[model samples]
Structures are given as structure tokens and as C-alpha cells.
Target: MPHPASAAPTSRFPAWLLICGSLMAIAPLSIDMYLPSFPTLAGDLGVDIGQVQLTLGAFLVGLALGQAFYGPFSDRFGRKPPLYVGLCLYVLAAMGCALARNVESLMLWRFLQALGGCAGMVMARAVIRDRLEAHESARAFSSLMLVMGVAPILAPIIGGAVLTVSGWRAIFWVLSGAGLLILLLVHLRMEESLDRRHAAPLRLGTVARSYAELLRDREFLGYSLSAGFGSAGMFAYISGSPFVLIELHGIAPSHYGFVFGANALGLITMSQLNARLVRGRSLDQVLGATLLAALAAGMVLAVAALAGMAVLPVLLGGFFVFIGALGCVSPNASALALAHQGHRAGTASALMGTLQFSLGTLGGAAVSVWRDGSALPLGVVMAACGAGAVLMRHYGRSGARARPGAR
Candidate 1:
């Protein structure tokens, strides 16, 4: 079938992109916004920084698992219902997080909060797929990165301010309020984009088979893995940056947001550049170039750390390049992955998200486990994951050529 018309007019920033972007922003806001509070959380909960990092891991785990459920549910029930359910759960769970009095309870609440927040992540992509062709989807996803990028740039800064004035717990209260606002916007402005004719069944065996089929598709695996590992590098940074910057480097907790936001600004800039580049170039071309850039940056970062040259300037430079490259990498990879999977967009999106966050969880966990009061662990993880992304893309292309009939 011919691809549906573009989701919204391309001439100007549309309302639909805004809404979808906000939905996608949920994860970033939830993850980045509270990062400045790691030290405070550790002190308040009577735990060390590593334990506080575990809470982040818990959230990533929830995000990964929750997407699996929401993907199928959105596919079967139409997008809006699962979003309603998820957002409500997110609101409640945010409150739970705010009220948690111990590290264990905070971890559990963070997990639940992620479970609720991830609906927006999966469904936003599916909704975009529901309305646009692959190339248009590429541009749209880039636009989304532009929209969603604001959250990370602002979240940490806002979070730090809240932490200073109201305390660490108040950060979650802010999150709770953000969740409510998004929920209201969804109810008032968003429309269900899933066409019933394309809806999949909610059967157990069918879902398993669908996911298995996705796993076996080499092209899908390539795009998914490349995006997953590239993104995993970012998660590694997020997991380790608090301790590395504040404790080891002697940066103030409040100033950490500026550093984080600077990298995020790089991300936003590169994503928009990708958007313009794709208008003339193939998605694969842009993806290939960015993946190489990421690998190079990752290596530079790893080398700097190993050489004991991981000063603030060196670390920020490496991170900006690596993370900025992801601006081009993720949107292109995602558009390519979902290019041929429109019939089951929700399922495809879910599987892609699962891979991304599952690797992300591992990245975060690896940092926490390797916490040695040095930046070496974070650097190594970023470099390794970036290499993984490049290899996956290369093999994915080779496999696609070898099995011309795979899709």
C-alpha cells in the first residue's frame, strides 16, 4: 500500500509533532531531571552513590519491560487506550517515588514510574509511523529529537533548582506535575492514529511469534542494534557522570546540569542538521557517517580516561561528539528499522525500544558495577557500545544483501 500522507504539514512546526515530541520527552525528563540529586539521595536514604545509581538501573529496566506490554496493547487496542493506562500509572508512581523513604522503596517506585512513563516512548514512534512514509518519518523523527531534546537540556537544570529549594523528593513532585500535564494534553489534543484495519491481535502465542520474527530479520536487527548500542553509550554516561563529575572532578552538583545540558545542546543541533541533510542524502549514508563519528569520539573518550587526561574540557568534548552523533544515528536508524514494518508498527517499535533500553540498562549497570572513583569505566562502556553500533550496521547491510527476500 502507498504510505499514508505525512503526519502533519512539513512547512511549519505542527501541533502533532509537538504532542508526540512531548510524549517522547517523558523518558528523558524522567531520567535526566533527577540526576543532580544523586548525592542528596544517597545521603538522605543512607546509601552510597552506587546504590543510587541502581535506582536509575531499575528505571531503565522498567522502561524496557513496560514497552513490550504497551507495544502489543497499543497494536491491539489502538494507541490511545494504553497511553491512558500508562500515564495514569505514571502519575501515581511518581507520587509513590516522591513518598519513598528508603533506597529499596525508591528503587521500586522508580521502576513503577518507568513502567508508566514508557507508554509515551513506544506509542509516539508508532503514531509517527502510522501517519508517515519512511523518509518523511526520518525527518519527523529528527523533528522529534529537536522537540524532545529540550527536556534533557532543561530537566537537569530544573531538577537542580528544585533539589536546592525543595529537596530531592521535590524533584519527583515536579515530575508528578509534568506527568499530569502531559496526560491532560493527551486527553485534550491527541488523536488515535492506529488504523483498525492494520491492528494486530492480542493473543499470547501471536505476540511471541511476532517478536521472534522481528528478531530474525537482519535489517531490523541491524538498525535496532545500531540504535540500541549508540543509545547505550548515552545511558552509560548518564549512569556515571554524577559521580565522575561531582565527586572525582570536584564540580558542584548544581553546575553538573550545565555540562549535561551542553552535550544535549550538541544533540539538538546535530539532529536538526540530520533533518536537513536527509532531504538530499540517503538515510543510510547519514547513519553510516554518524556511526563512524560516534566510534571515533568514543575511542577518544576512552583514550583520554585511560591516559588520565579526562579533565572537564576533554570529557565534555568527547561526550559532545559521541552524543551529538547520536542525533543523526538514532532517527535514521529508527526510520530505517520501521520503514518496512508499518503493518505492525507498534510491535516493531516495542522491540526496538526493548533492545535500546535493555542495552541501556546493561550500560548503566556496567558503570555502577565498575564504580572505582574514576572515569575509566564510563569511557570504556561508551567506546565499546559505539563500536557495537558500527559493527551491527555493517553486518546488517551485508545480511540484507545476502538475503534479498528476507523482509
Candidate 2:
């Protein structure tokens, strides 16, 4: 089917938003939902906590690699076909995770699950680019962030409850059910979003040229890198928080879910506030301001870590602001990056996801390497990511220059 007009039909906007938001939520849901189960999962698999952590890193790697293929494939085919295939793979992988007896098998299945599930994240951004203008897309992304926030807010809580009733393996069973539900929703409600006239070829040379073209756009690179590093900080927190809060700080497992959910709620609240604040303001202005806030929060977090200060309150408050700052940065940076790449929205979005997840994997790994069962690794890594984002936007001269032939 040919793509619809630039904006989807008014009557369909709610459904469109729901579908895109839910799809985008898939990754966070998968990641956060099982987090509360980590201790129990490790015990059941007869592995150390560090080995369990590796599974998360492996999932990030799979997500990073998978987007490279799915983005270009979606551009060649249509959105719905690749989405269907990905969701099917997700269901199978999730079920495999539920059945796995060892950490090795569990890690492999989780990686495969990410490979299947990340199609939603890549395509959700591409769909936003395909359907909206730059500023409008930023606003839409904020709304999608609000919707996506529900998953993280509820996921750990739900995972905890399920673990209480059953076991860690049941978490994967629940995720498989989620995949099935999403597949049915796509089949019933989602129309093809890719326009036939803009279809990219499937050849390797064409794919290389497309990414090469995007790389040459300094404006795109600045925004993409800033967003990528900001995401790295968030992933660092994701990788380290369970150990820091529960294992080291002595927070109970059930309460850990609430603490995690509270941070997610803060992020959701900030995204909505950002959507309103950016109205009539330039997205660049919003992005610059938020990066500064993130940088300052990072500094405070680092000091608290290094000085051996009030650990829990410092982490909670610092991250409340730090992650909230991301609420502003991510959508605006994404909008700015893809503003000039309408014809290759999928490729551009794919590259953006690749950068974010690849950097995120590294940040998470760094935390593991420096793990001392304290909040120091989490604080230091997150601080570095925030500082890195600020530097990229400042020295990178965001939006000051563009590629010669850029849109």
C-alpha cells in the first residue's frame, strides 16, 4: 500500500499513537520487567550475579546489531511485514528463555529476544519521521514517551508480583504473552506506514551509501551522538542499579521495584512537561538547556559517589533530575537528526538506534568492570555519559553546518 498523507487521518491518530507507543515500549518492558527477578534468576540458573548481568549486556548487543538489518529491510519491504517477522521471532525467543536451564542458554535466548523485539524501537522512530514534520515529530515523540513510560513504571512491579507468585521463568512466559498480544494488535490495527515511492533497494551497496550519506551530515551526527551518550547514562543505571540498591544498599527486592518505578514516573512526568515547554520554542534551544541540566546533575552524582555521601538520597535525587533531563534531550535530538532524511527515515532511525544501544552496551559493561558493590560505578559512568553529551553538543556545533546535499 502507498503511504497515507503526511499526517495520518485524524480519526486514526489515537490508534496510531497507541500502536507506536506500545511498540516502542517493548524494549523497556523486556528490560525492566525482568530486572526485579535478577537475584532469583541467578540462583535458579546456578550462576553468579555478574554472569546474570552479562545477559543484559548481551541483549543490548543484539538490539544494536539487529536494527542495522531491520531498518534497511523495512525500507525495502514495508513496515508491517518486518514487524510481523520480528514479533514472531520475539515470541519464540521469549519462550526459549522461559525453558532455558542454564545461564548460557538464557543469555543466548535473551539476545535473540532483543534481536526480535528491537524492530519496534527502530520502526517507531521511523514511523514518526515518516508521518510528521520536525517540530511536530518532537512533540509526538514526547507523547510517545509518556505512553512508553507506563511499561517501565509497571514492569518491575509486575515482575516482582509474578516472581512472588511463581518463579523467574514465569517472567519470560509473561513476556512471550506480551509479544503475542502485540502481534495481534499489529495484524488487526496497524497499516503500512512506509511509502512505496521512497522504498530503498535491498542491495548492500545501496545500504552502505545510505548510511554513508547520513554520516556525512554533521547536523545529524551531532544530534545522534548527543542522544546516544545520554542513553548510555540511562543504560548504565539500568545495569548497575539492582546491585547498588538491593545488594549493597540493603533495599528489599519488593521495594526496589517501587524505587525503579518512581524514577520512571519522574521521566514520564518530565517528558510531558517538556512537550508543553517546547511549544513555540526551538527544539535546539530545549535540547541545549536540558543537556546543561544533565551535566550539572552528573557532576553532583559523581561528587556524591566519590565523597561517600548520603548514598540513597543522592542517587535517587540525582537520577530523578538526570533521567528527567533525558526526557527533553532524546526526542528533540531524534527530531533534529531525522528532520533532513525523509526518504531514508528507516535507515536514519536505524543508525540512531545502533549508536545509542552500542554506546549503552559499552557503558553498562564499564560499570560491570568497575563493580565494587557500591554506587560508585553507577555514578561515575552516568556522570561521564552526561558530561559527554554536553561536550558533544557544545563542541560539535550542533546544526551549524549540514552536508551539501542534505534535505
Candidate 3:
């Protein structure tokens, strides 16, 4: 209908949307795709399930550290180069993961893979900031969520199928292939989203100042922490779900996949709903309402667990509502935070992601340490994160109102 060359920005929107969504999908794929392989991987590597699970922690650690590194680098160089390098590293690390001889080696390779994969996560947000105003960016993020959401929904199914026929090693090989294909798409279709004039030089002092500026902005920290703490509950759910569903409730692995997909669908549905709601509403107002909703859901969850009423059905309903709240919180927070940080979008995006992953790691670790083969620990951690988000949002808004000549 439109000339292809002129269509790059809008008319051929689906092409770029797919690319950006794929970029965001990289981290989720890396995390969820190998989950079904945990048992087989432990057996093959001569380690127990707990040891195999450490690879997840290692990957998350890498994701936190690597996002911090690439955000500044992307700000200095153009977005495209950092992404290219990160994807290349991802491919290499995935190959190493496939060839690993032991749990320790696999952990190292997984960390490297995460380090590389996080570039996509950070840059995807930055690219959205680069192209759109705050409100538009929120909608773009929800659309991206729709595309990226499919990865978590399908990755386990795909991984389970591969593990069924070709074994766990084949799973790594498949990830490697996916990385290579994404790299090719980037080279062929994606243009530089960051304008050269806005590029800051990569110096230690400059980088420190950039981050320092972000930390000093009260609104930015509020939105970032609100989003981070809101999303942390889902990470706790992910870390605890396998045990709760499969081991405790005795759901079969095949059926667990379906249950997992169902919860993820809740998340996806809420995110798109957020996109629609925001069209006629302010991001701040929508965020406030969603944070409160998530808090209520978390309260119900914790009360159920504390009272020993955490049957599988109850737990599933709580997860559906809680994660759906995050779908609203995340896009709004990112858009609001970056609204004022347009000049330093990469650094802001990076810091936001770093906080999110760090908080998630804390929630996940709490489940491991406090796990008593009951749902209490998971429920408590989830509730805490939600409460923290609500408090942050309240403080942020109050502080904004107190500022002289504030909008």
C-alpha cells in the first residue's frame, strides 16, 4: 500500500515492532526456555537440582551487571553497535553453554550469555524512548510486551519439545541459532535510533555524573523503584513455581507448562489493556490505581498463605492478579521516568532495569532461604514487593507536589 523505502518508520511498522519485540524477548527466552530441562540437565551434569538452579542466579547476576555496563556504552556509542556486540557475545556464550562439561562451566557460560543478552533488554527500552514521547512510548512498550510475551508463552513448549527428542544440549544450540538470526535481522533492517548529537562520550567521570544526575531526580527514582518492586513478585513466583506446582501439588511437567502459559497470558492481557486505558488517561493516574490493585492482590495472597489456605487454585488466582498489575506498572513507570531523562535515556533505562533485576534477585533468594515446603514464604515475599511499590509511588507523588512551581 505504501512505498517500502518510505515505510521504514511507520507503514512497515510490524517489521520494526517484531525486531524490537524480539530484542526484548531475548532475556525471557534465555530464562524460561531452559526451565523444563532442569531435571535432565542435573542428571546429565552429575549435580542435584539445587546446583543446576544456581545457573539461574548466575544468569540474573550477569543480567544486572551487564545492563549497567551497556547502558553507558550505548549512550556513548550509537545503540546499534552495542547491540551488535552484545548479540555476538551471546551467540558465543550460548555455544559455550552447549559444550560445557560440568555445572560450574555451565554457570559461567550462562552468566556470559546473560551479560550479552541484557543489551537487548536495556537498548529496547532506550530505542522506544528515542523514537516516541512519553505517552506514545508507554503504548509502544505495551505493544512490545504483546510481541515479547509470546516468547515466555512458547519458549518452554519449544524447549520441552527439543529436550524430548534431542536432549538439553540441543536447547542451548537452539538459543544460539535464535541469537544469530536476531543479529542478522538487526544488521539488515534496524536503523540507528539514537541521534549522534545526543551521544555522550564514554568516560568514567562522565558516566558517574550521568548516573548521579539520575539518582538525584526524585521522580525518576520513584518511578524506577515503583516499577522494580512491582515486578519483583513475579520473579519470586518464577523461582518458586516449579517446586510449588510440580513437587508440592504434583502437577505433571507437561501440564505445568500449560499452567505457566496461562499465568503469562494474564500478564500479557493486562499489559495490552494498560495500553488501551492509557490512551484516555495519564500515566501517573493509571500507575497509582494499578499499584493499589497489585497491593490488594498481594494482601489476599499473603493472608491466604498465612492462614494455610493456599490451595493450588487460590495460588494461581493470586499470581494472575499480581502479575497483571505488573503489566500496568512497568510500562507506565518506564515512560514516566524517561519523560524527563530524554537526554540520558540509556542510563535511566539501564538503572531502571538494574534495580528491577536486583530487587527480583532479592525476592527470589528470599524464597530459597525461607522455603519450608509451604506457600507462606512465596506469598510473604510477593506481598512485600507490592507494598514497597505502593509506598514508593506515594512518596514520589507527595515529593513532586511539595516542589516549588511543580506542574
lDDT by residue (1-407, candidate 3, tens digit) is: 11211122363246766789999999889888888787788899999776777788788888888899989898888778889999999999999999999999999999999999999999889888877788888888888888898988898778888888999999899999999999999899887777777778899999999888777777888888888888678778877777787778887665666777887788899889998999899888999999988888888889998898999889889888898888888889888878777788788889988988888777777776677888888888988999999888876676566656877
List the candidate numbers ranked by TM-score, top first.
1, 2, 3
TM-scores for all candidates: the values are 0.97, 0.96, 0.94
Ten contiguous residues minimizing lDDT sum, candidate 2? 4-13
Top TM-score: which candidate number? 1
Q: Write the per-residue lDDT of candidate 1 for residues 1-407, one digit (tens) a residue.
A: 22254555555467677889999999999999999999989999899889999999999999999999999888898888988999999999999999999999999999999999999999899988988888888999998999999999999999999999999999999899999999999898887888887779999999999999999988888989999999899999999988888898888999999999999999999999998999999888999999999999889989998999989888888999999999999999999888888888999999999999999999999999997778999999999999999999986676566665745
Best by lDDT: 1
User: For every model in order, what is the number of clashing pairs?
Assistant: 0, 0, 0
Local error of candidate 3 at residue 132 (angstroms) = 0.7
Across 151-247, the per-residue lDDT of candidate 2 in tens digits comes to 9889999999999999888999999999999999989988788888778899999999989978777777778889989999999988888998899
- Output the lDDT of residue 306, model 2: 88
Better of 1 and 3 by lDDT: 1
- Model 3, residue 112: distance off in Å is 0.7
Span of 10 residues, lowest total lDDT, candidate 3: 1-10
